[model samples]
Target: MSARTLGRARGPLKGSVSVPGDKSVGHRALLLGTLAEGTLSVRGLSAGQDVASTRRCLEAMGARFEDAPGHLRVLGVGLRGLKAPKAPLDCANSGTTMRLLMGVLSGQDFPATLAGDESLSRRPMERVAAPLRLMGSSIATTDGKPPVRVAGGTPLKGIRYALPVASAQVKSAVLLAGLYAQGETAVEDPFGTRDHTERMLAFLGHPGPLRSDKALTVPGDPSSAAFFAAAAALVPGSRLTLTRVLLNEGRLGFFTALKEMGARVSWERGGVHARETVGDVVVEHGPLKPLRLAASRVPGLVDEVPLLAVLCAFAEGESRLEGLAELRHKESDRLEGTAASLRALGAEARVEGEALVVVGPARWRGGRVETRGDHRIAMAFAVAALGGAGPVELSDAACAAVSYPSFFSDLEAAGA
Candidate 1:
């Protein structure tokens, strides 16, 4: 669809929903599985275009998947077995796929070139390349951007690198390279990013002894659940529970920020595997208070800030988001997109430095918003449409297909 309007709920929303698998984990699972020995099976894989890109690319490198009874069975070739692709690896619009895959491919013994769509091509890959280069990986790129050439089989050695910011993509890139390095690879984040790559690695049988409350040391991801959590929060009468979402200390700050702002959320301990924590979440209708998100906490919710901005519109007071300057360089200039979307809904929003301050509890007037081909921006605005003062029509709604193809369907099933 070119564009579509989300009808406003007359009253409180009610129902149950099962959000698709975590996007971050979906990507890592596919990649790690390809590097693991024997058969690996994945459940709750996200049906998003980005994750699908990784799947297809992996298949092209000689990995295979089987549709099994309860999961997708992946036959991994282990490290050093991946063959060079016949053509350049096309990552579509996924920045994570390109950046992290570059690290993984860097240590291999084949020459691989990674390319992407226009958006991905513009994203900076130099940050990742810097550390990979330190590991002795020969990486050549056009001014730190995509269409990157990595001559694999470099003599890589482990290095301790401190991130200038909290970015899971960079962290995962280093960790993925560590898998091929001669020594241990450690990435220290000033502020924590998502831990999905770390968590999935632990689950898949490579649990690292990483410290928490300071810097996470694993190779997993948790940013993937932010979208699903937002959907649960927006669907008023909805009472959906996701099974086995990782709750690393650094990543839990988003939920803490939400609770401080007064969202009705609860957790239940579930089974565990591969030394990673697993649990369930139940969200229901409740009053939401506004929150002042500082720069210190920005790394925790970096990927979810767009969705949280949508939540701010439904809150009781003004919400301020700081340390969001990193967003300027994402798939799109998300800070501008977030502000523009809030304006479309009649909420007062402005950008100061790297912070986004949203004055709200203002009604979302059903107006058309351009997503600028950013998936997070599209999905976040879609959630806001549920609370619109009128029906909200989002242009470029197709972008949601990149990370959450069934987002609308899932929301509808939840009675939104």
Candidate 2:
């Protein structure tokens, strides 16, 4: 148990921080770059271990890479050129690497097993497997979890799948498999999950002109930016600036929640990169209203739920987050972990059916936060501790390296 005790903030946090590149976009860009038949120069790839797992897996399958400051160059192996990996793909803690590559491996001519850490091995993988099977790919999960095995030479035929739930990973898996299918593979995503995969595919000329620029710049991650924003919102008189964050509509649920909670959240659209919108976001402290989150918005809000739950821990009303059953399958059972984190922060919180209801104006009387080895939860608790009345001891502070390696240091520099 790697622990860190965060002292209470004595003053409002004020600073500008550039978060790491968007992890979702970074994963898609690297994967698509592997399929493109030219040198793909990528700027600002995510430095987290999850994206590192993706890059390592791609390399094991014969993609070569060149490295330089703030840039990574992928020598394309082309769509049909990936060789059989020399060993089982070790995905570590990245569910994204295992899940998305399950789609990519399904269409390959060699057998592969997508394995991950114990945490990831327990996550549901059948959501991706069932659809890949429909497309004639042979996939077997360990009772609907990881160690997902993909058999070789299973010729694919694309089928339009209507998602039983809104999951961007599942959608991307099926679509990536669609690339090798005999017919058009289409996924009807009515819930509007982040389309980073679709956009990257289009930008890489999947069904359009193949003349895309070889260089791709990834936007800064919005999910990482949310923690500082939440801290600034909770700490009175605070102002924090986050530069070059991804501004996709699907990724803006946290911002919407922030706005409804009365934080002065503002942004300016700056430019576009790899078919993603980039912008600078500023968050300021204000009187917070309790968040009344609807169930329909769950898909877009999935990653931000914990951070929002932290905000709800201090907001001035009863905050109810519905349709969070998906939270149970993450690195931890976050639905319960979130309620627990709120309670630890001195708020009344519970799970009533599929909804998590938090009643706040939290007293910030902090104690030990149980992270359950999940990086996002660890980071959220760091924010909770930043605005706390007492120091918080996190159970797994080192887990933040899975995504945001510099999180604690950045928190300090940005006014912890």
Q: Assess every candidate by TM-score.
A: 0.90, 0.98
Model 2 error, position 136 (Å): 0.4
- Candidate 1 to truth, TM: 0.90
Ten residues in a row with the worst lDDT in model 1?
211-220
Error of 2 at 54 (Å): 0.4
Clashes of 1: 16
C-alpha positional error of residue 236 in candidate 2 after TM-score superposition, expressed in Å: 1.6
Q: Rate the local accuracy (lDDT) of all candidates.
A: 0.76, 0.88
Show model 2 residue runs off by greater than 4 Å. Answer: 208-213
lDDT of 1 by residue, 1-416 (tens): 46878766445545434556666667877888778777765666777899889988887788888877656777778877789899999999988789889888988899988999999899898988998999999998888798999998778999999997668898999999988888888988766677767766776667442211111122123454555566556656645565566655666766677667666777665655444555766666567778898898887777788888888878878888988999988889999999988888788889998989887688656787888898888778777776554477778888888877777776666566
Q: Please give me the total number of clashing residue pairs in predicted model 2.
A: 0
Error of 1 at 164 (Å): 1.8
Candidate closest to the true structure, highest TM-score: 2
**Collision count for each candidate, in order:** 16, 0
